[model samples]
Target: MKSLTLPAVLATALFALISPAIAQYADGQDATPEQAQAYQDAQGCILVLKAAGGDDNLQMAEQAMAKAKELAPINGDDTDEKFAKSMKDWEEILGLASVDESKQFLANCRETWSA
Candidate 1:
């Protein structure tokens, strides 16, 4: 297979890094730094899976689901617990974002955290 040129590799890396910060999910106005980071990560996975499409999309979705199932439930201060639960919930849906219910997952993120 042909290798990617240095510029191509750099561009891809930059895009991948920035895509996560492109508002894939909303961090509530009151979210703490930790919560905000987790929220963004979950959003990144969701957005990535959505953009993957086709069979690859399903594969990405499955990996997300498996990772989520392995995570322990939230168990800490109110702040930690809230974000933990929120992250777990949003991320779990990410594994299915390329399937028929993909939009449902994104919708859940918006509806999940209403002001």
Candidate 2:
């Protein structure tokens, strides 16, 4: 039989790694102009995380997510990002690849700010 424990352990660690941002999304509610700016900052982190790749990249993505969550608001404030939580959700769903992919993703995200 396969060793389930090893996989379980790895999964646990992975969850723990992402828990911070997950917690932020759950506990964090509403948003401020500052939070919105913070999300904008996250756009940068995402690029680095996307390009950095590997475990380090995951960590960076988590960091960027935290920042994005910070800026994420329940309602639209100064930024039209809509919901920071949603953006974080989107980032995860987007399945970020390498730096180039991240650049494209961030560019699209940045458009929201420009328009």
lDDT for each candidate structure = 0.39, 0.45
Over 26-106, each residue of candidate 1 has an lDDT whose tens digit, in order, gives 433334434334434343344545565656555654554343333212212136465465455444444433554444443
Per-residue lDDT tens digits for candidate 2, residues 27-55, read: 66454434433544454456445654677
Please give the lDDT score for candidate 1: 0.39
Flag regions of model 2 displaced more than 4 Å.
1-34, 74-115
Residue 20 CA error for candidate 1 (Å)? Answer: 21
